[model samples]
Target: MTTARRKPYGVKGAPYAFLLPATVLFSSFFALPIGYAVWLSFHKVHVFGLGLGKGARSEVWAGVENYTDALTDSELLDGALRVLGYGCIVVPVMLGLALLFALMLDAEKVRLAPFTRLAIFLPYAVPGVVAALLWGFLYLPDVSPFSFVLEKLGLPQPDLLDGGPLYLALSNIAVWGGTGFNMIVIYTSLRAVPAEVYEAAKLDGATPLQIALRIKIPMVASSLVLTFFFSIIATLQVFNEPTTLKPLTNSVSTTWSPLMKVYRDAFGTGDIHQAAAEAVIIALATLVLSFGFLRAANRRDKQEAAG
Candidate 1:
């Protein structure tokens, strides 16, 4: 047998040369910072004497002290629970509305589909902070149109910015901002499906709902999975919306979410070591939740294929 030929040096080097800038950027910007955070997580600053000079403050091994503290902190646990509740409301409602709108757009003989689609997606073009600010004004009692409508109808206008209502208020902002983007994604996937599939289903006398349930949804499962993955990640890292709302309302704390808690530790408290530990834990938790859902989806797909 002839020996396998090797790629020429110049040919082999071309790809690496092309990738050099990205590699350098990734290492400098991404990999190195992650490595540094990991290092910081396992270290603590020890004060010597009055802690006045360079040698006065020394870095020592922490041995998971920060991690243990974070894990056992009731404030962190409460914040996590709050986020879980917020996510429960946001994810389903957002994705459900997205899928519904996408199906409606994909339906034949739909009215003003282009205008409606653009209007639904317009919120996506607004910055998250701006969107939150606008919504915060809408939720305010004095300036809210909803409050005005309720007053006209002789109904009590419930405070949307406090207590349990606060959860719904925040969830609404997230859903409104996110649903349009997800709708566009799902709608794009629906458009990719072959027209022949719909033609055959129609010939077989399947109703629009039946086609949506049996064919359209199944065909767009990959897009749903993709959107779900990103939604979960975004929900976990919720910061901007809540941060924007904090100035408008007293209900939101500095440590409203795990990420906020990390920020509080890092800057507010000047404890980088603890902040790094919390950040790492949050990162690991996100990875675990994401991959766990992906694996479950994969297994379901395999089972469906086997059946």
Candidate 2:
């Protein structure tokens, strides 16, 4: 007790050693790329002498000019609107189907539960591009079995790749791919409820529907919130499906979504600075919307608990 005790070397350094790999990877992949994007967002290419050669073009500080232009860009705004509409359809339908399937799987009398779950979840295993291509072929009038059946039945074949139906077409792909994952999350949550809780509900004369609505749903609220959070983020970042379907239809433009516009700006037009600015804006929007939703959910939970 007279002298301060020294910690063992291994114990003292163990935490840091454990964290080193994660820190390095995060710095290399996430931190560096984000930092570079922020830096690029604040700069632009200054061209001189007819802008002909590499030496004539140089990087210069742009301040908020890039941001200003991005915020006002009509294409970006339109893309954002399109994505918002797409999200409206995808979020509700996907989550609803997921919840429905999870509840069904949790039912006592459900048959072939494992096979049914696997069948629903299998689409998520397919790559987004492949899923889109598969759906794209099915949407085509010349190749689709659905279209052929409709033609034989004398029903008008709706154009799924253009106009209003295009939204449904894209939303279906997202729902098909996403619903299974969300279902599994909710189903796991459902499984975690203590058996005694269900017994107590049954003793209180609660029917299966009542037990599900009052007990199971409330207990699994946290999982629902989590799935909703992820669904929102995914909806905001929709790119792969639309991009994959672009070659099959004229309705999907290069700027069909915000991320698509970023791709077009950065690579299509070789305007990296503007692209970076737009990318930052999208990131900020995503963060703001995501956090705002989380805050609202937390507040509602607090209110419900108080009641």
- Which candidate has the highest lDDT of all? 2
lDDT of 1 by residue, 32-70 (tens): 999999999999999999999779998999988989988
Score each candidate by Cα lDDT. 0.94, 0.95
Regions of candidate 1 where Cα sits further than 4 Å from its true position = 1-9
Give per-residue CA lDDT, model 2, range 1-307, as digits (tens).
Answer: 4988998769978999999999999999999999999999999999998999668989999999999999999999999999999999999999999998999899898999999999999999999999999999999999999999999999999999999999999999999999999999999999999999999989999999998899988999999999999999999899999999999999999999999999999999999999999999999999999999999999999999899
Query: Candidate 1 clashing pairs?
Result: none
Off by over 4 Å in 2: 1-8
- TM-score, predicted candidate 2 vs. hidden true structure: 0.96
Query: Could you say which candidate leads in TM-score?
Result: 2
Model 2 per-residue lDDT at 240 = 97
